[model samples]
Target: MAIVRFVLCLMVEILVLPVTILQYVGIWDSLYKRVFPHLMCRMTTTINDKMGKVKKELFDKLPEFASSSGLTILEVGCGSGANFQFYPWDCKVICTDPNPNFQRLLESSGAKNEHVKLEKFLVASGEDLSPVASASVDAVVCTLVLCTAENVDAVLKEILRVLKPGGAFFFIEHVAADKMTWLHFIQHVIQPAWRYFGDGCYLTRDTRASLEKANFSQLNVKNIVAPLTSLIKYQIVGYAVK
Candidate 1:
C-alpha cells in the first residue's frame, strides 16, 4: 500500500510540474483568465445566497458603507463584478483587475448599477496601481484578493498611496486558521494544490497581519467562520482607515 501511494504521488507530481512551470512564467494567468469567467459564473450562482448573507453582515456592520455617495471607490481584483450590487447610488467606481477577460462582465454589472458610474476598467495588477493617482480615491475595496497578490506588501502600499488621507480600505478575505488546529494542518497540506487551482491563491496567507502592519489609522477587523468549506472558512472582514 505504501509503495502504491508513493507511485501515485509521483504521478501527480509529474502532472503538476508543467502547470507549476507555466505559473512561474506567467502563462498560467492568461490561460486561467480565459476560463475564469465561466467557472466563477457557476460558482456565484451556487454560492450567491450564502455569500450575500456574509456580505450583508460585513456591510451592515461597517459605518458609512452605504452612505459613501459621490465618493470615488477603487475595487482591486474586482472579479466578475460580484460586489457591484453593494455599491450605493452616485458613487463613482474605478475597477482594476489583472484579467482583461472580466471586462464584459464588469460592463454588464455596471449597466445594471446605473447609479454608480464605472469610471474606468483598467487592466492592471493590484501590486502596482500606477494608473490610479495617489491619495485620490476616497476608498478602496478588496475581497478575497490578497492571497493571490504577487506582493501583498506592494499591493498594500499602493492601496495606501491611492486612498485619501482619511479613506477606508474595506476587505473580506479567507485567512490562515489558528495554529495547531486540524483545519490549519489541512490548509498547510493542501496549499500546493489550492494555490495552483485557485488562481494563485495561497491558503495560509495572514492577510489581517498584513493589513495591521500597513498601519491603518483605524483597524476594525473581525474574524468570522464563514459558511464555506473548512479549508476556507475563517475569514477576516471589516475596514481599515488610512
Candidate 2:
C-alpha cells in the first residue's frame, strides 16, 4: 500500500510538473491570474446555487448590525465578486483582492447585481488592507478565502482593524477535517500539491482555531458538510463580532 501510494503521488507530480515549473520561473502568475477568474466565472452559478441560502441567511443580518442607515461592507479576497448578490440592497461594498485580474469579472458581477453597490475594488491582500481606513467599515465579509491566506493570523488582525467597534465579520470557510479521520489523512497527503494548484489554498488549515485565537468579542461558528467534493466538503459558517 505504501509503494502504491508513492507511485500514485509520483504520477500526480509528473502531471503537474509544467505548472510547478511555471510557478518557479514566475511565469505562472500571469497565466494563473487571468485563467483562474474565468474558471471561477464558469463555476459561479453552480456554487451560488448550492451555497446561496446559507450565504443569504448570514449576509442578510448585515443591515440590522449596521451602525449607519446604509451598510458599508469590506470584502477581503473578493474573487469574481461571488458574494455580491448576497449583500443587502443598496449596501456599498469595498472589494479587496490580491489578484487584479478579477476586477473585470467583479465589475461584471456588480452590473448584474445592481441592488448592491460595488463601491471600489482595490488590489490588496487580506494581510494588508491599508487602502481602507481603520474602523471605517460597518461589516467585513470573508467567504471561502481564509484557506488561501498567506498569513491567516495577520488577515484576521486586519479584519478586526478595519471593522468598526461592534461591527460583524461574516465568514464561510472550508476547514481541515477532524484529526484521525480518513479525510484528514488525505488532506495531509494532497496539501502540498493542492496549495500549488488551488492558488495557495491550504487543505489542512484549522481556520476555526485561528479565528478563535483572534480575540473576537463574540463568535458563533458552526461546522457543516456542504454538498461539494470531499476534499473541501468540511466547512465552518457563521459570524464574529469585534
Candidate 3:
C-alpha cells in the first residue's frame, strides 16, 4: 500500500513539476501567503496541543530569565504566532518571517496570548537578520523552521549572532531519520517535490548535524517520533546554549 501511494505521488509530482517550478520562481507566493497562515495555524495548534507533554518539555527548558522584562526573544519564522501561547508572561518577542501576509494572523493570535507581548514584526529571512542587532536578543526560539531555510547553516549562524552570550536557542524540528533504511530512501527520493510543495521544507534535512556544526557552547539534542506521517515523523527536540 505504501509503495502504491509513493508511485502515485511520484506520478503526480512528475506531472506538476513544471508548474511547481513556476511557483518556486515566485508565481504563487501570494496564494501561499494567503492560505498558508490559516492552514499552518490550525495544523500546528492541533498537533502541538496533541503532543502536550512534549511541547511542555521543550518550553520548560527555556530559562526563567526569559520572563524578565529586560530580556528579548527572537522567534525565527513565527508563522501565525503559534508559539505565543507557550511563552512565559512578560517575555517580549520579536517575530520575523519573510511573508508579510502573516502579520494579520500573528496580530490576531498575539491578542489572545496577552501574557507575551509582541515587540515587533520584521519582514525578514533567517539567513539575514541585519535589522536585528548582534547579540541583542536574550534568547532565540525556532520551531519547525530550519528545514525551509535556503541555507540552514547561515540561518543558525544568524541565530548565534543575534543571541547574547549565555543565551540559548530552543528548537523543535523534523529531521531525516538515522541509518540507510527504506524510510530514509523514500525521504531522499521525494525530497525535491516535497520541498516544492511544503514551501521549501526538505524532508531529508539532518538538522541535528547542522546544529552541531553551528558549534554552540553546549548542546543537548534528542530524537523523537512526532505524531505525524512517516514522511515527517522523525524530529529533533532540545536546546543549544551559546
Candidate 4:
C-alpha cells in the first residue's frame, strides 16, 4: 500500500512538474502571497490549530533541551510570525520564508529592529538556505512545513548542518493518515489537484520516517487528530542533538 501511494504521488509530481517549475520562477511574490495564503487558510485552519498547540509545547519544552540563553534560533517558513511571541527574551531568532510579502510583514513587526543586528531575517527556502551558517544555530524550528517542501531530505540535512553540536531541532508537522480510510482515499486520489493548489503539499508523506532518516537520534513521535481529518495525523515534538 505504501509503495502504491508512493508511485501514485510520483506520477502526480511528474504530471505537475512543468507547471510547478513555471510557477516557482514566474509567479510574482506579491501576487502569489495574496492568493496563496488566503486559499490555504480556509482549507488548513483546523490542522493549523493543532499545529499551534504542538508549537506551544515545543516552546515550553525547548528550554530543557535547547535553552534560549545565548542561542541563535532559526524558523523556517515562519508564516505570519505566529511563533515570535513564544520565544524567550534572550534568544536571537531568525525568521525566514521565501514569500516576499510575509518577509516584509516580519520586518515591519519590529522583530528585526528591536533585536537590533542580533536578529536575522532572510528570504530563504527550507531546501536551499543561504542565510544560515553551518553549525552556528542552537536550534532549528519547523512547523507544518515539510508537506510543501519539494525536497524534504535536503532541508533536514540543512537543518542538521546549521545546528551546533549538542544543539537541538524542534518541530511539529502533519503526516499521512493512519486512521481515516475514506478521507485518506480521497486525499490520495485528489493529490494531483491538491498539488497544484497546495504548492506541493503531500499528505501521504510519512513525516516521521523522513525526520528519522535524516539521522535525528532519539526518535519519538505520537499520533494527533485535528477537527476534520486523521490525515492531520501526528504532532511530533522530540529533539535530536547535533
TM-score of each: 0.88, 0.93, 0.90, 0.76
What is the per-residue lDDT of model 3 for residues 1-242, given as tens digits with 9 covering 90 to 100? Answer: 56875786687688778867778788766577678777887888777776667768787666553534465889999999888877776778999999888899999989999988899999999999999999888889888899899999999999999988888899989998766577887786677567756877998888898899886989988999988888888989998988
Better of 2 and 3 by TM-score: 2
Task: Output the number of the TM-score-best candidate.
Answer: 2
Candidate 4: how many backbone clashes? Answer: 0
Write one digit per residue (lDDT tens) for candidate 2, span 1-242. 55765676677678778888888999987788889888878776787899889889988888977765678999999999889888888899999999999999999999999998898999999999999999999999998899999899999999999999999999999999998687887787676578776888998899999999997999989999988889988999999999
RMSD of 3: 3.2
Question: What would the TM-score be for candidate 4 when compared with the true structure?
Answer: 0.76
lDDT tens digits, residues 76-158, model 4? 88765556655655667787777756655566554544532237668889988867888878888887788888888999989
Model 2's alpha-carbon lDDT is 0.89
lDDT of 2 at 151: 94
Candidate 1 residues lying further than 4 Å off, grouped into runs, are: 1-15, 22-27, 60-69
The TM-score of candidate 3 is 0.90
- In terms of lDDT, the poorest run of 10 residues in model 2 is 1-10
Q: For model 2, which pairs clash? A: none
Q: Is candidate 2 or candidate 4 better by lDDT?
A: 2
Candidate 3, backbone clash total:
0
lDDT against the true structure, per candidate, is 0.82, 0.89, 0.84, 0.69
**Candidates arranged by lDDT, highest first:** 2, 3, 1, 4
